[model samples]
Target: MRAHHDRAARALGVICEGGTEFWGWAGRTLGRAGTATDGRRVWLRMLTAREAKATGKLWDGNQTAEKAFGTLGGRRPELLAVHDAAETGVVYRAELSTRLDMPVVSPDPVLRSPLSLSPGWWGSLRTALSTVAGATTDRVAVRSAYVERALPEFVGAPAPETIEWVTVHGDLHWANLTQPRLRVLDWEGWGQGPRGYDQATLLAYSLLQPDTASCIRECFPELGTAATWAGEAVIVAELLQSVARGDNEELAPPLKAWAKQLRERARK
Candidate 1:
């Protein structure tokens, strides 16, 4: 870790504070700078391959939040600064200074909301989906197939129109958010798709009790109310999508419950 930190410092050239234990950068723009402490510096993330993998997972989970930020930046250009993104990392860094020492390391509000399934959020999701669909050259069908094949039980039942097309933060959860203004971040897997896609994912991640989920849904009537079956389908699809690539331990339990919910609902 020390070597990694040192390498990062040398590469970026800043006073690696916290004795290289913490990830940050320190350097000088002008000579004899005190009281000022060169508050004009940024830190490099010094993560090992394992940590890097974890970061990837985090990014994957927060892909929606990141995409949302990008969407917002495009529409409201004044809201954020466009930082140069590395070839292998998420694009667009938030101007943390505006948030007053709020580093981009916390969860976002969209992630924390009760999963009432907001129709209001539909506007953002719709825009996001259109953006992705528009960007691709010709493989919209192929990717849509990936989604259906990946989670047929869930996505298959909800046909094109029935499901409603809107830009969704495909991966909406607690960790994907930032505090204060609830800025969403991460954009690796963002694209256009279903309207309830964000809602279902948000509910699954709300960590609220069943009743709470119901209340939250009511709070956002515009998102439209859903049958238990709909929620089940979402779980099944999300689980299948997460595991089809490979069975991830983290998503297993919830996905299992989702399957059971679908089965139980079908029986009724």
Candidate 2:
């Protein structure tokens, strides 16, 4: 995959600096820090999969985000160029984007512990989220059927009727956020979702850090309100479903506890 990524860089006329290479889950994506021919720092990402399975929203997400958000006031890396080729029934797509100098807050998606984040960082994050939510798009992130089907079974809460949908980052976890400053990444899942879904995702991942969780709730007070319960319930169920799949098992305890609390709240 690294070889393919490097070759893709050469083909795109970008030079990959040899030190750091970032790999995504299950080897589906590889990203490297690089420079354009003009020495402008850039990030190059390569993805490969069977040609038959590579056509969909996930495949086109970054391009779609580039067109839809247009750099997002420097909150997101700008997608600059793309290179595509196919070989032996596999498709390889490479994307060159503006590289962020700041690193992600964590190596994992779930924040097992807390880190001190400045008030300014939180403010920037809120602004970025608000801007994203205000955008208009036909893309769907969380489907009602999934929420209706999974909520009762996974979260023990009846699904809320008439969920208000809003645009969201869709995968707003720790690894997708940068440190000392705020930048959101992994935009492949950004689209319309039930209100508070993004905040719920962040809060769910912060449960192990109780203070952090409280801070998130404080920052987005709407999260604990009845209006956002529909979205929050779905996010909790989604992560619990992940636990059932043998992923993020550590979140199981807090998630189950939180689900129980949500159920109690529903009863009230």
Candidate 3:
């Protein structure tokens, strides 16, 4: 793993400059993320590919963000450069952005902290959500077919109702969000999806911490509304699949309990 990290660092250095400095790194299921800097101006994220197959276009969330920044503009990283290797199926994407103090919370579900987000922060989040929700996009991040197949595995069957779809961050979680200043990161999966999908995903991830989950629910009342229930159902099914795949084992117990609770509530 150290060797891979070193190689990624070198690759990012070559892309940025000869004097790029390594900031930090963490191993992920799909790939590894390393923060690098060229000293004075920008911070570069070197994303080394692992499990992601070379199928679609080279750009993902970064591209979506780049397009949205022009009009939607708030606190999002900008795409700097992309190094694609079709033959090796490895892609190195570099993004430039201002450095953040710390993440709002750890990406790992095992970590817990007392809820500390202020009302202003919650309001800012709502504004960001509105910005993304109002934006236009042709990309389909989560396919309806996959949702249809996964929903029945946990929820038995879907109820007959009209679902309102909108542009969503698609992969909104703790790690992708920064605190104090409130900047949202990781745009690789931003696209059109069922309304409230981002909020449901965040709520799903916060299940391990009851206080935090409740806080999120309090802030985003849509989580309790019937209109967004379909979106929440998708999140539950997605999390359940993650548990079955042996991913996020730390979150499995709470996630399963929450799934059961959601199921019971849906039937009522």
Candidate 4:
């Protein structure tokens, strides 16, 4: 992945500098910060053969996102350049994007504790998410069949009779959020989903921190409310499924608790 990133930088005519290398989970993605030949700071990210699937729109989310939305008021990274190549049977994709100088809210996707954030940060985040939800896109981030099956098994039966679909940042977790000034990272999964999908996801990841979770509710009041129950159930089931897979082990208890509440609500 590093070799691919380096190759892409060379091809893109960016001068690689500094040792700030970051890798995605299981080293699926690798990126380095550098400046363009014209001295513009940028980030070059490369997908490894394992994580590189060139078939689906979801696979090329970052590039597609640029077409779908132009920065979303600077909350998302701007896609600048792309380099695609194949070595053997696998394809490697590298993208150059406008660099975000802020650090992420958390290294892990799930927040284990509370962190005080300014009102300005919350306001910015709220605006960005709202803008995404209002976007028009043909991309599908969540499917009906999976929601129908998973909801009954992981959450409960009696799915909502109606659903409002909207554009969402499919993977809106703590690690994907930046602080001080808001910036959402990893745009490879933005698409249409149940209306509150992103908010529900961010809430699920912040379950351990009740204060932060409450703050989130205040910021996005429609997220887990009765009107958005279907979206909430979808994301709850998704995360709980991840919990069952031994991925979010710590989130298991809270997710199950939330599921119990959802089951009761569904029954009602």
Candidate 5:
């Protein structure tokens, strides 16, 4: 696939045999992720013109996440390089870290351990969140106006101003995380956003299994606060948008129910 990007470029052919992951929403090939000739495995993400616009400050996000790699401990992949692709937008390639021995427990029904995670795992997650919250970044992930507008669409109420904003892994879900090892991936959307947004997103994605959701809530008690409720509302609004975009159809039902529950809570 990289060869298709530039037939004349010799380096493109050096990409070894791994499949590509496409993001249909962006309407572009994310990149051909595989091992290189030098035996280094990497994920090369390509952002098309439209996708660059949709993502906003695409390069800044990579830089921020790269900076975070130093502080986030061993829980995230190391950023290898970022290159300008001219009309095609930027290209970000990172070293693919070793995944956990246990598969991710969400989205996929692969054989895995119980939904409950160890207390040490929870501590590492909190440590990662705290590390990210303290990291500085100039990007605005989900804007205040966006949250306000989206909340009304799903919950029939404005988001509370009491919610505190912090740097977050904007796209936090089962797919972006690995278990047992507890490594986080896909740093394209890392930026400043509402506190507890990541936790809310993880919980929302786990709603299909009550036990998993309960475990997440137990691990992150902050999810019960008003701020996290607002964060959940934001996530529900995003998921509804995804549903409208013809994505996440399977999650639509649970997402709607969760949104309605949050709406009812807001009424009081």
Candidate 6:
């Protein structure tokens, strides 16, 4: 135990003890040297082998997520009160100065079609189907005519053939996005492949309002046209990714709405 203590202290470069040992830090972070009354205002986390292994891929996603939040801040600067961010493990510690108090910027000045009822939303449904298409035997439960038509649209459009790849935030939802402040943080699973994947993931998770959804699309007019299809494709890949991880309909409202969207799209 003494050897463990010595090694830990050496790794941290400080003599830490008591419950601090269970804090599970991998390295020592230099903090402001101040009087005993002030204590260390900043913390340094020791990176573990596991964190190191996941850092590269997770960081890439984190950067993209950061960009998305930055975009939100750009559109509605007041929505996001960004406090600070610094490299720590695979994710960045982005601090928010304030919380969002208004409805999401869905169908706002940025997106054109509104994410709720827009064709882009269907993409999320299709993505969900793709996620479970490989697992459960209930193929009919996940089938859709919209995907049948939409899938063919991308057949030769410089996109992958299998609809198996795309950039997406594996987990997107309201909790990840602060309201009124509209700050977005947390970048755990992010990558590229289909389009609108992130938007769909977030929508599905948050159960956005229809009017708000429209605003979301309107806010991102670039996604209103053919570009929206690419976004949809990405959503499909991400949906399947989530299903494979064994996520179920704990958030039944969003899951139901997602299903309803596919059915509505199929009718069209």
What TM-score, computed on C-alpha atoms, does each candidate reach? 0.48, 0.97, 0.77, 0.95, 0.78, 0.39
Pick by lDDT: 2 or 6, better one: 2
**How do these models rank on TM-score, best leading?**
2, 4, 5, 3, 1, 6
Model 6 clashes, total count: 47
Backbone clash total, candidate 4: 0
- Candidate 1 local lDDT, 1-268, one digit each (tens): 4443343344433444453233221420101111112454443332223323433432332333333344454421121222222324423221211112233322332233333334544344445433543442211111455444544454444323234444444555544443333334434345555545555665565433465455445543433334334433654576566666775445556566665655554455
Backbone clash total for model 5 is: 0
lDDT of 2 by residue, 1-268 (tens): 7777878999989988888778898999999898999889999999988999887768888899999898888899999899998888999999999999998898888887668899988888899999999999888889888988999999998887688999988999999999888889988888899999999999998988889988898889898788788878988999999999999899999899989988987887
Q: Which segments of candidate 2 are over 4 A away from where they belong?
A: none
lDDT by residue (1-268, candidate 5, tens digit) is 3443332122333353445454524445454455545666655555445434543554456556777565268887666554444435544332233223454445442112346677788778888887888777777778888898898986667888677788888877776667777877667778878888888888777767777778788888987667677778888898888788997677788888888788777777
- Which segments of candidate 5 are over 4 A away from where they belong? 4-15, 18-27, 31-39, 50-55, 87-117
lDDT of 3 by residue, 136-218 (tens): 88877667887678777865556435678888888888877777767887776778788888998988887767888888888
Q: lDDT rank, highest first? A: 2, 4, 5, 3, 1, 6
The lDDT per prediction is 0.40, 0.89, 0.66, 0.85, 0.66, 0.38
Q: Which ten residues in a row have the lowest lDDT in candidate 5?
A: 5-14
Superposed on all Cα atoms, the candidates' RMSDs to the truth, in angstroms, are 9.3, 1.2, 4.5, 1.7, 4.2, 13.3
Candidate 3, position 153, lDDT: 87
Q: Single out the weakest 10-residue window by summed lDDT for candidate 6.
A: 28-37
Candidate 3: segments with Cα more than 4 A from true spot: 1-40, 48-58, 70-73, 81-89, 107-111, 159-161, 264-268
- lDDT by residue (tens digit), candidate 6, 140-257: 2112343455443422223333443343444455544434433443344544434455555554443335576555455445443444454544344334445546653344445444
